[model samples]
Target: MQIPLSQPDITQKEIDAVTEVMTSGTLSIGSRILEFEQKVAAICQRRYAVGVSSGTAGLHAAMVAAGIGPGDEVITTPFSFVASANCILYVGAKPVFVDINTKTLNIDTTLVEAAITPRTKAIVAVEAFGHPGGMVEIEQIARRNELILIEDCCEGFGGFAGDRPIGSFGRAGVFGFYPNKQITTGEGGMIVTDDDRFADVCRALRNQGREGMAWLAHQRLGYNYRLSEIQAAIGSVQCDRLEEILENRRRVAQMYMTRLLDNRFLILPTITDDVHMSWFVFVVRLNDLFGPTERDEIIKGLRASGVGSNNYFPPIHLQPYIAGPYGFKEGDFPRCEFVAGRTLALPFYGKMTELQVDHVVAVLNEQLEKVQMVRKPRI
Candidate 1:
């Protein structure tokens, strides 16, 4: 009955791909990396893709390659992993925190325009927890502002809005190949873009500013963020099965919704009608009825019952680094900060079975019942 919150769906294909790369001896900047790049680009319908060490590297490269540097401000949501904001600081650029929509939990397109200024260079919008983040509206904002946009597709690869994938909407969309992503590359990332200039910049930045191949001449100073052939090979193999993985994840999401339908003490994650939602995580927000301290108690109960659950992220601005020196505080992004303390991610992955899913939900309901009983006196 024990269920993990997230698990990589690795199989024999990943093994075979890695073995082939190991035997080739051309591990770094080899054919495998090239192959994986092509596949990743094709998935997003982008003309080019450059593989890198991780999604963080992909975001950093995107920001730098787009000519964003000291004093430039990148508008982004505070309701995501720290890496999203940290990438902005890597280029010596400032990350301007913006609010997120309460329902979709993605950066609010309505709030983005007000945040942009003359120094505003790009927008790094995360497709938080696999929802596509309403790319259509976001793109319109980008077009109007003439801002470079980097879709942080780390949690949202394989997700589309009205046929265009999330990453393809922006100048450069980045994907995470971390173990739990829709497809894993054992800690790798890809930058997909239709703009040839951006693509060249990404490729150069990933390999220490080399225009072509590792041994080639350097044009600008860059870091060694290239992905190994072994990782790319694994990514390419995983890429082939992406559709199947998305289907499985969708099925799991539906099961969770059905099971938790009548639970008034918790708010289910919301998905917009525009999204295909490649279900990366199922976030459940604790309702006020659970009382002030009940969310923490429910997590403990879920763990004791062996159902994996945890919060997705804390608000980026509220992090100590940004809060102390950058002058960010609780009331800054009220919705994001509020959600951060209440939302919990439940067990979700492509490989989970119906029985496993049911067990997780059954545990959630039982825990809620316990909380209600304990808090009845207060009510």
Candidate 2:
């Protein structure tokens, strides 16, 4: 009866795609990878897509192709996975940390401009948990200040803002095909863009800097970050079922909302009126009204009840890796630091059953009662 945090919804279609690749004896890169790139580009409405080794590699390649080098700084939020900041460092540029809007968990666009310096070269914004950031405002700022904008859409594949798709709003957008993401290919990622020259640079950098169409031409520095046709086949197959995947996730999220609708003490997530969510990971925050003790207790109790649960993130700023190096102490980014401590990620996958949702909610309520009893003064 244990509910795992996430599981890929692989189907016969996925197996057949992989079988076709194996049967062809072209297991590396060829037609399948090409088709994957085409399909992803079409999904994002971009002119090109390059399949890379992983999301980290896609981000690193985007930085390199965009000419982010030493002595430069890239402005980004500190509430995401480390790769967002590490990509800047991969190209010898420093990551300038910005705080996030506690609600959306997205970068605070209002604070972006003051962080810009003569050394700042780019803005790397992540669409946290499959929700688009305030891209319109971010884009306006980038254009006025003359900076490269990279959309870290690793968690927001099918998400959009208004009539525009997320990744297409910036100079380049990166996505991951890791198992927990919108789609799965075991291990894969992509870089999408409307600029042909940037796409060519990335393709060259992925292989071995061989701009020459022939395999032997080594024109610039590069790495072996190409995705195998096996993975490409899986990505193509999964891409075909993405709409179903997204719909299932969305439905599960709605169920949780209806079941766990607590107005007084639990801050349930609500998708903003216009922004569409891909529902990568359903999350909730404990309001202060619940008191400080309930947060950790509820998370522990949920796990004990066979309901898989984990914290959203520990704020990249406070992470041990960056804390000392960047001189980030507790109060640096209050919202990010506070949310990191109280937010919990509940189990909400495409295959989770309604009964499991009920069990999870019950466990949470029991924990809240236990914590309240502990805080009550003895009469």
Candidate 3:
């Protein structure tokens, strides 16, 4: 039974692509990287794409390219992967936290404008759990305030906000290809943008600040964030199969929904009509009657029963690194904290079978019922 939380779908095609690159003489900054970047850019409907070593590198490069430095403020949601906020810190800028929408789990657009200030420089909007909700309003807010919009599309590759792709909404969008993501490059990321100068800056930032592939010339201080040829080759093949992968993920998502939709004790993911969701980790939340203690117990019970589960995110603002320095405490972002407390990411992947899904659901229900018996007053 031991269903793992998440897995990557890799085929023989991807294996062959990696093998070809490994045999090729050029390993770094080669044609494979160019092909991968081109495929990503076209998919995002952007004119340029820069391949980087990781999603964190891509976001940091975007912040630098946008001229976000010390004393500047970047607004973002606390209910996201820590990198979404950590990227702001990398550029020596302050990350101004905003609460997220309870249902969508993305940053609440209503609170975004209020968070903007004279020093506000950018908005790092995340597609939480791969749902591109409220991005249109966030884009409008950024535009009206003249703020740089860096879409953190790390969890959202094939998603769309209305008719437009997820990466098309921001000034520069970043995608990650970790092992657990929709696609994997072992470890890599891509920055997509229509702005020529921004694209050029990111390209330089990933290659030791070299301008136009000069071997020894360094234009500015930069980190070594270049993606290797082998990773790029794998990414290129993954890009070719992106649509099929997404469809498979969607199918699994539907299976989970069909099985769990009637559970009164759990709250399933909310997918709005306007956005086409790219399924990442399928997370479910315990109802209001259940607190963090109950949620933890359920997760532990599921794990003990050979079903993998985890809290999708702990609030970024409450993390010691951010909280100690910024003086952030509990209740700063009530909505985010509330949702984060109960959220549980279950086993999810494109190749997951119906029997595995059934096992996970059964374990979850058994755990929920056990928790309910112990806390009868809340029920």
Better of 1 and 3 by TM-score: 3
* Alpha-carbon lDDT of model 3: 0.93
Q: Output the TM-score of candidate 3.
A: 0.99
Give the backbone clash total of model 2: 0
Query: Model 1: per-residue lDDT, tens digit, 1-379?
Result: 7888889988898898888888887888778888889988888899999999999999999988889999999999899988899999988999998899988888998889999999999999888887875678888899988998889999888888868876787898998889878888889999998899888888888888888655768988988999998998898888898888888889998998988877787888776677788878888998866533687788888998888888778788978888998998878988887778788888889878989988888888898889889989987
Candidate 3 lDDT score at position 194: 95
Pairs of residues clashing in candidate 1: none
lDDT of 1 at 213: 55
Alpha carbon deviation, residue 128, candidate 1 (Å):
0.7
TM-score of each: 0.96, 0.96, 0.99
Q: Tens digit of lDDT per residue, candidate 3, span 1-379?
A: 7899988999999999988877888888789999999999999899999999999999999999999999999999999999999999998999999999998999999889888899999999999998998999999888999999999999999888889898898799999999999988999999999999999999888888888656899998888999999999999999999999999999999999999999999899987788798898999999999999999999999999988899989999999999999999999999999999999999999999999999899899899999999999756
TM for candidate 2 is 0.96
On lDDT, the stronger of 2 and 3 is: 3
Clashing pairs in 2: none
RMSD score of candidate 3 (Å): 0.9
What ordering of candidates by TM-score runs from best to worst?
Answer: 3, 1, 2
